[model samples]
Target: SGRVDPVTAARIGKVLGVDALILSTLTTLNVAEVGGISVGPLTVKGVKAEVIITGRVVDATTAEIKDSFEARGEEIEASIKVSDLQGLSFGTTAFNKSVVGKCIREAVENFARNIISNPDRLMTHQIELRGKVVKIVGSKLIVDIGSRSGVRERMTGKLIRMVEVEELQQYVSVPIGEVQVYSVNPDTCILEVLWAEEAPMEGDYVDLISLK
Candidate 1:
């Protein structure tokens, strides 16, 4: 096969002064008869062809796999042709080829759409956080948000309390106390009490309100 070799692809990228090159490989191709047609009087039927394609993409600069994708498509019914008078001898070879080409194009388009929709694949950030209390001693509540969630020393958050109503049977969160993030780890953090009229305890709900 005259597929683009890695060395050739790299050389082309360098010549073009490009940062990256996309290389794809056809891994699988499947063709099958799917739909059927009906004939009058004798009640005979015919079939259509469908095609599927799967492939992988690689980056030429680093020779790393960027992504892989798959797609499927069916042939156009009007394109099918018959050769013999007998309904049993139907020709769908052209339809099969068209479907295969369509599937390949559709697969590539779908892959690009997914990448555009999820631009966070390359970078990640901590926007908001929710926490639960695992332990409580006096007025301090130990929360489950750690260093991985961007928590650091001297960070200040708020303590909220959810009060259950017997009439409405709903829980309402009320602001109870202000606390400071004193210490943090990969899995947990300790909160120091700043000012609270009522002390919070274990199993209390904690939320990261804002940085102070």
Candidate 2:
């Protein structure tokens, strides 16, 4: 019903459990007749249509615009009588088959191609999964992040141990090992330790690896 602001779009994206929201605007649209051409007994003109769209990728958690792009498409219908376009209107079957429709469809396809070709920035970078280790039993560890945080079985994370840095006068995380999710619940998940330099203990942290 109305244009959504970036913050609202981000809020909606979060509610939908999506990493990003795509915001698109119609930057330009034009339809006009080009010069006419003669073919035997008839003089026909070309009707040209152009469509341009501007797209933005908004990060769901941060409400930040991560990327922006522009896509354009054009189509020309040759040998067409100007009288035949009198009733053309958007969303009608006649309009959809016209030059403008094809131009819009092509513009959308270009937008999809742009996003797919640059997946590292638009898709892979949006995941943020990290939580503290709550419990440990035998070879398994329970982590605070679960299905609610987009956790799934087989997901892996690197375990981090808090080590005190005497010189820095602070505690810092050291990568101790890795663990893979074995099962998931609403607010927690069970993980099987993959490998570790030292045994991971409770209160350690884990950072989920982003899927490629």
Candidate 3:
């Protein structure tokens, strides 16, 4: 919802049935013009500029901003030439043309490695496909994720097997194993289990994942 305030978040939560939502914002992807002629006699021209990026994560329910991260790239346009525009120098076109491409790539790469690579960082909320393990023969698993859910061969994800908690009268996911899509049809797929804590059985949960 617009602005992500309490009222907006509450409306969203009402429809989605989630108390708190993880929100992420890109605070800055600065692209300031840095090179030109000195506007005033004391002004500097063609100075090197840093490529900077910052991200913030917030809790929607309480409207509280939580974790923040930043990444700064190396100074670009280390060398500069005074504009050739007879006396009146203006835009940074000439300077930016030389380094803007490389600067942006470095900045984004640094940001991802420093900030988004954490295990507990932003996670996808989209549920494309979810199915149950209908059958298992040795290390091979049969799941319901297939062409209907856009699943393809070689795709991989973890199998979350459900375990009934007798004391709590509820069910919880037990990590069954990592699985790879080996074959797919219109309605189902066969998976090859690469690793498992316990042998997967009927009724284990299998959720599809995106490579992106």
Candidate 4:
């Protein structure tokens, strides 16, 4: 199960009730000895472990690959014995402390950072949701939307404040700022304001902008 095909991804998505899925495969894992190399005043020889991973974001409903990325990790141990790398099983404490395990961890970390930095790349379609700013503390804004409303972490929204037009005698919804959800609950979600023209207040409206 190193690779998740489109059909398998779709089936898993349906069972998990998710709109999208991220599939990753370990493309390469290698351990090589670096022959003695000059390092300033001394020659250095070491064992190097390298790992390469490929990742994809698939639209569960359409079974389409929306985005793809690659990450790599490498670790080198100077003046080390190759025997130390042998007989190491996956997930063991000793293995985790080994160079190979560290390489894998770094690769996964790189993958996560890549996804977090490019959120729009994961969007297969748009969804509309509206909620209210129920509370505020410092720069944190609490919204009414929650997991029950299909809300998840990392979702972003625009805060709208109503302005009364003196001449028109009507209230208009004006976008004041933006916020990204960081925490979620069954009936509520907490957001950190990204920016604001005016400080957000309770009773303001929220227009959902991004899906988690």
- TM-score per candidate: 0.38, 0.55, 0.47, 0.58
Query: Relative to the true structure, how large is the alpha-carbon lDDT of every model?
Result: 0.60, 0.84, 0.64, 0.85
Clash count of each predicted structure: 0, 0, 0, 0
**Worst lDDT 10-window in candidate 1:** 82-91
Off by over 4 Å in 3: 1-48, 55-92, 95-124, 150-155, 162-173, 209-212
Ranking by lDDT: 4, 2, 3, 1
The TM-score, computed over Cα atoms with residue i paired to residue i, of candidate 1 is 0.38
Q: Which ten residues in a row have the lowest lDDT in candidate 4?
A: 203-212
Off by over 4 Å in 4: 37-40, 127-212
Deviation of model 4 at 33, angstroms: 0.4
Q: Of 1 and 3, which scores higher on TM-score?
A: 3
What's the candidate order when arranged by decreasing TM-score? 4, 2, 3, 1
lDDT of 2: 0.84
On residues 1-212, what C-alpha lDDT tens digit does candidate 3 reach at each position?
A: 23665456546755786544443344444444465445555454453435677655444454454556777665434335423322432335543344544565577788778654773443323344677888988778898768877788887788887778999999987777888899999999999988888878888887767531
Error of 1 at 72 (Å): 65
- Show where candidate 2 strays beyond 4 Å: 36-44, 81-83, 124-212
Residue pairs with backbone atoms closer than 3 Å in model 4 (clashes): none
Q: Model 4 TM-score?
A: 0.58
Q: What is the per-residue lDDT of model 2 for residues 124-187, given as tens digits with 9 covering 90 to 100?
A: 3536589899989888898998888888899887999999999999999899898899999999
